[model samples]
Target: MHIEKNILDNVNIWLTPTFDEKTQTEIKEMMTSSPKELEESFYKNLEFGTGGMRGVMGVGTNRINKYTLGKNTQGISDYMKTAFPGEELKVVIAYDCRHNSDTLAKVVADVFSANGIKVYLFSELRPTPELSFALKYLNCHAGIVLTASHNPPEYNGYKVYWQDGGQLVPPQDGEIIQVIEALTYDQINFKANENLIEYIDAKIDEAFVKSTIENASFDTPAEAKDNLNIVYTSLHGTSIKSIPDVLSKAGYSNVNIVPEQAIPDGNFPTVKSPNPEEPEALTMALALAEKLNADIVVGTDPDADRLGVAVRDNDGKMVLLNGNQTMVLMTAFLLEQWKKAGKITGTEFIGSTIVSTPMMLELASAYGIECKVGLTGFKWIAKMIKDFPNQKFIGGGEESFGFMVGDAVRDKDAVGATLLICEIAAQAKANGSSLYKELQNLYVDHGFYKEYLISLTKKGIEGANEIKQMMIDLREKPLKEINGQRVIMVEDYDNSTARNLFTDEIEELKIPKSNVLIYYLEDGTKICARPSGTEPKIKFYFSVNEPLDSIENAKEVENNLDQKIKNIIAEMQLQ
Candidate 1:
């Protein structure tokens, strides 16, 4: 139970008068009876990653608490003052349905307001995208949201956004971290200036909803909208209100919500985790879809930024669609709708992440629309949107079940994505088809791409070191082949270079440097390895594709692709 000298020093700092009485009492208890816990909590300060800060909720420097939040807010406040000198600084703050989210949000607003920055705080809990939209709509310099997107209830997060309505990227994120690291606990101003804190009214909500509606490509026919039985669950988060409101406003009257999950509960009582990426998270929604004989079922994460969808396949059974399938289906549908509406101006473009299905590139190419790939996270996708002001951004998404339909909200918007998905389903129903069938049609038109992801969780300090070493080992000894297929290309994003294994020629990568390694096989297979920035885990994404000439062979083709990915995993010893 011996604590390192540095850890003990860090712990003692919190026991001082600088911290509140409650925090000091907790620290004292940990020091006296729970030295191990104290060491874990004070081993190091919670890292402010490229996007923002996230960690388990507790009373320590390494954990997310009032003090950590205060320090971060003050750092942001100082950065804002310096970033925009001599101007009236403004920031919008929002929170999701997480423990201490509202309180943390208030603390954030207080810090901003105390620093002479105007604060537009949401009157109540709202989705992350709405917060992003409000930041832009209100013309604020920065914004913050209090919620870990899909993490467990014990975990919470702070996501920062800039004026362009996207998460902070590049020099901005690095600059903010520098400011945060230079400040001490006592430097933070936790006092509130009530006069400078303003509650965002319903006007912002109305505008957000309007923008979502306008982003819809197809108008749901009254008959299809009325007859389409849609089952949705917010997974006990912020989308409970916004999703239904947008669906109802979009002329959908037959929407059925999972009653148990409709309530906003940070505990996520009904499911093990609130993430829609896991099929288990959508179990209740799928069951409801079965009972209601619905056409489609959709669920959003706690923060309502990512979406998970399920639709009745041709076999008359409901099945969950992976993040890649959802993106492909939605992207194809949007392209078709745009083509039909004559909105394809040859200047339109779409975007996806490197880990997402390569079919996105193919789909965009088929329609003569540009497709750009970025590193993981929607922030990179938003950066692409910002980079292409001359070209229209139709949609963008990643394989993590996140999607952004239009530029209105730069980040992945579940509310708008849900609405657009329903519209796509309704349009399919109107055409005597279903979303599953549409997916099959897309596969038939383009190629069939199947994607699978495996995430290995490594916790604590030792685990972090292990994960770091794993990445280093992979970089030093890159994979030469996988599953009897020759490795054609190796992309080392961390070093910002891509090399052709066959020719030994190298080229610079256009994207920012990230600790990710991607391998391209000669048989059109892709394997991506990257560690999570916010969580203690490493993720490997596998994507394999083949031509699908007929719907009758879809199951066989899909099974083959799945087996190929399994073989790749086995050969790579990832199992």
Candidate 2:
């Protein structure tokens, strides 16, 4: 058995009297029996990314354990004190259905309470959005949610939120990271001050559900609501309670739950990965929908922040719609309802990520509302809402199956999005159409946009280095053309600059600096390359669009766009 000096040093620290007996025993066993696992577990400390610190659950600094969470919580507590001196410090905490989520959440609460900060922890498992909502609804100084968000069962995470109900942004995220880095393991205060801890459940749930119902608008007849059969699966996550309750409250009685997935299980036994974006995750739901002859099938990820939808196509077959299509449908539905209700004031706007379909921007323009593009995360969209305090945030979504219907919660809310999507289906049925048909109508009016995503997963430290090198290669050697289409412009988000390749003009990008590069083609085609900040993966997003003259032309136009994406992928040697 061999070990690097740095790894051995870190391991020796864990074996000291400061660590728990269980953890020390595990480290000693790993050292004597599993040297490889020991090396991987203690090689490095998990750093905070755009979301937060997430890693495999184990007894190591590189893993998500009590010591790491306690250190981060203490840092947050210190920062809260510095940011709000002479004021009562309060924070909300929630967890999802993951292994050790509940236990980890209690540790977070203990650390916060030990620092004299008030903790409003959920009595049971809850979705990520509710934690964000509780942060603002309770007027807390900060909040934390224990979730890995659609990751494998072995992973867990800690997401920090601010008073604005959004994830920490800009200087705050950096400052908090500095505070955590400066602290040692022994410096963490893990003592629990039971007096400062309060269990919050029904009150916050009631408020969140009420707000969700208030945000829903349905112009369809009563029969439409009864006729729209919706099959919802929470992927064994937290939405099992709130999503159904909200739908029932909104007059949706034809909803069916996948009995297998309804029960909250930390292991997510029913699906290979609890992510609805994966087709396999929705397999059970789709089967149940077919058996019941349902109209729509919806699934939410483990934390209930992202949504995935399957709609009955024109051919009477159940087909899954990608994230962009779902976003387009929901965006169109909300805009139409607003116009009908006369709520489309000029002071309203929408938001999406730059990698998302550009049709969102076009749709907002048609409704006389501005659409803002941020970086890849929902936190940026929330930041947009915070930036435009005077403007009403109608709704926003991303290429990932995450959408926020209203401004009540600052994160991508699957609960509210599910309700609104069901409403869209019911209203479409009342208008002598289906959600699939309404999507076609949107294309007829707003042009047909198609989007595709290619994610190359690279694991471990070597994989992380490979992803970094991929980004560097793409940035240093810009693409001049793709599949015969001339590259018109290149936007380097890291440098905050956009270069017009044809005109040789450079302009400043007003968005925050990120490690992303986008290439614009002459025919309105776009290609984006971005590395995942939280995981060891690099993703490439492709979007292309063309005019749809009528419903009959949809299939042909869609096929053409699909082929175009395939051609671009082949030409770029992405496969």
Computed on alpha carbons, the lDDT of every model, listed in order, comes to: 0.90, 0.91
Q: Candidate 2: lDDT of 458?
A: 95
Candidate 2 local lDDT, 1-575, one digit each (tens): 67899999999999998899999999999988999899889999998776788889998989999998998998899888999999999999999999999999999999999999999999999999989988999999899999999999999999998889999898899998899989888988999999999999999999999998888656556788999999999999999969999998888999999998998888999889998878999999999989999999999999999999999999889999889999999888888888988998889988999999999989998999999899999999999888889999989999889999888899999999998899888988788788899889999998999999998999986888898898898888888988899999999999999999999999999999999999999999999999887777899999999999999989999999999999999998989
User: Which segments of candidate 1 are over 4 A away from where they belong?
Assistant: none
- lDDT computed for candidate 1: 0.90
Give Cα distance to truth, residue 399, candidate 1, Å.
Answer: 0.1
lDDT of 1 by residue, 91-114 (tens): 999999999999999999999998
Deviation from truth (RMSD, Å), model 2: 1.3
**Residue 383 CA error for candidate 2 (Å)?**
1.0
Candidate 1 Cα deviation (angstroms), residue 6: 1.8
Off by over 4 Å in 2: none
Q: Between which residue pairs do clashes occur in model 2? A: none
Query: Residue 30 of model 2: what lDDT?
Result: 96
Q: Kindly report which residue pairs in candidate 1 clash with one another.
A: none
TM-score of each: 0.98, 0.98
